[model samples]
Target: MNIEIKVAKKSFNYSGPKNWEETEPWLYAKIFGIGKQLAEKPHALFALPQMIFQIPTNVLQFLFDRNAMRMVGVKDEEAQDEVMGQGYALLKIAQSFANSEAPFSWKVPKVKAAFLGYNYYGPGDSLGMLTFEEFWFAEAAYERNDTNALIAVLYRRDPYRKQTFSEELTEKTLKDLQALPELTKEMIVFNYQGCRLGFSKKFKHVFPKKSVEKDDEQQPKKTKKNSGGWLQVAIGMAGDSSVEFDALRKLNVIVALQMVENKLIKVKQLKRKTK
Candidate 1:
């Protein structure tokens, strides 16, 4: 089945403190470089948690068709499936960019194609997950400057913005985030933490459930079944604030969905053990 992916572009008009063109490009280069280094001979993991974790809006549009999106009283599965189809595709682009082993000098053909495809997912679309939109792009976003420093141009400060993320929540987010390696967590936190911190119930914002189970929560972002594993990098010096867990969880879900669709990960049902 052919899915219609459409995106329209216009020069950003949101007025604030950010000069996105100047700052954002540097951040993007920073993330691609970090993610590129994290990649290995075949698979690598670069540390730019926030950069890639925060899906570029253009890419997201292709993943989710805003024109077809409508929020009813309650979440619906069919609608979710439609959105999920796009969601997975978008996440796949992020992961592929982060996981590919190509050097900084060599851009993968597929990745280049993905960026071109994303440029097409344009102004016609509404951002997926409104809560994240509010936190990352809303008029009063919690974070001022993203890794790209767009926040600096968006506004100087919102005394009201600081009112959103509380002390207790920040502590929890930090502790959980601490558990994740710098290399692995930076990309997750930088791009996702701001949004996830908004909701305490959401698993660091990435796991299916906000309540992290010891068994499931500890699972590495990149799992190795054999000798190969992602290279280690400090997620901290990543230069972006660590994001909430839920956002990371969301990113992971996005990645997992894409892997499944791309046949990178196979789906299987765990049979209930007879008591």
Candidate 2:
């Protein structure tokens, strides 16, 4: 006789990755703080991890250095020429994508992902859902497939529209985003590295209580510019200036891929049939 007993598989809630604060506070900041901006519910759309992982390493390096070099102010016509020479390889890669047959539209995930860390409706509950196009809404549901903890922040204030995850697939949209206008060097550098910005102002005070309350009341209110990455080169937050550039470079690669996955870059169609 054979044993016939079977045990049930245990299923636990998705509590999110462990040690979010210690391990990846930057990622947490995007998933957490950006949503806090709206008076109503706010949701963040992130490119799927598989899409992010597909970016070529050289492209990532180019973007990282491009942003970093700009940050340090690589100026002058001669210097600019030298910079372009250094970026020749990157330019070739970009040209290849431009010549590809697949519509940039094709790169966007058929099923995109979002993260809803806070329940705007109530505790442990959801409100309304949104299609990925709309940036802000009363409430939006996070997709379940957003499992990979990695994300790239699209740093824009209210009404600042860029081609985000299929908002537009026109050549003009691709050109504008590629130029990265209204964006500071820091914003490009840090955001590309996946370091969350604007959270420093919120997360600055660890113990949110009486002391902080008194300080807030006493401090004069000041307007903070929406541009620039708040956490870029923030020694206090990172704990030291010794943080490795290699890691930063790697993280930015995903951000760069997210750019493609969002369809912000135009990939030329391989063949266009004559009408």
Candidate 3:
């Protein structure tokens, strides 16, 4: 939200994030740190405008003090108290704006058809538009925090064509993505994180569940080897054959995940029968 105030006989308008969804991940971390400081020291309220607005410390100090002294009935000694009061009021207003209780989920990006001079499209809201290969590679990139690779996988030049994954295209796209501004990269990552959350919720049954330990006598002990994470999942779906894997990767992500979920349910049923 925008807050307009006059300082040094000049009016200025400053804006802060209106909600958690609007806040950048880096800014959110700074705000989190500020919260801890405020909890320990109420006087930390004076530091908020500087943190939120990212203005010079001296300018903010002048803003508060000048505003405080303008009040009709104020002694010099009372100015400090008035400043603190104003800070507290501002803090409350900011809190009201920033508080968010709803679970965060991905919304369709506002700009869906193009980015950075490239004509491309993202996986539609259902994510059914992505090939399993593209989805898997994007998730792996996200796990590695590789922003360029993730962007390369999730966006494609052809929305209707089922193009095979191309190393040449990806390499060129990575160079293009690297030239993007830092803020643009952050926004892309933020949107992707939300999409991931939505995917997990939609395909919760396909994801591995945390195993609960049982009494030694009540359940047979089982061990599993550490393996490539998403790669391993892909391999299993492909029957561990390279040719089949390539074909499997061409399947739609929604279909691939549904197949995995069905297999998991059948395996569980068979295990119960054996027990």
Report each candidate's C-alpha RMSD, comma-separated, in the order given.
22.9, 28.3, 8.6
Highest TM-score: give the candidate number.
3
Q: Please identify model 3 stretches exceeding 4 Å from their true place.
A: 1-116, 209-234, 240-244
Separately for all candidates shown, the number of backbone clashes (residues 3 or more apart, or on different chains) is 45, 2, 0
Model 3 agreement with the true structure over 1-275: per-residue lDDT tens digits:
77765433455667877654566546655654564566688676666656676656655655456454455334355655655565556667656543443224323232222355656655665555778877877888888989888877766667664667776777765665566555455556766766666556666656554454556686835544333344566578678588998888888887887777676677679999999
Best by lDDT: 3
Question: Mind giving the per-residue lDDT tens digits that candidate 2 earns over 194-262?
Answer: 221221222332211222222456774553443322223222233444554333322332232243333
For candidate 3, what is the lDDT? 0.62
Order candidates by TM-score, high to low. 3, 1, 2
Off by over 4 Å in 2: 1-202, 205-243, 252-275
Local error of candidate 2 at 60, Å? 53
Which RMSD does model 3 reach against the true structure? Answer: 8.6
| Residue 62 lDDT, candidate 1, scale 0-100 | 36
Q: Each model's TM-score?
A: 0.21, 0.15, 0.54
Candidate 1 per-residue C-alpha lDDT over 1-275 given as tens digits, one digit per residue, 9 for 90 to 100:
11233223222222111111222434544664555465363233312322544434544443354443433211455645665565565445546554443221111111111222321110100112222223333323334433222222111123223323343443433333233234332333233332333222232212223233344667645433332111111121122545633443234322332333333112112223332
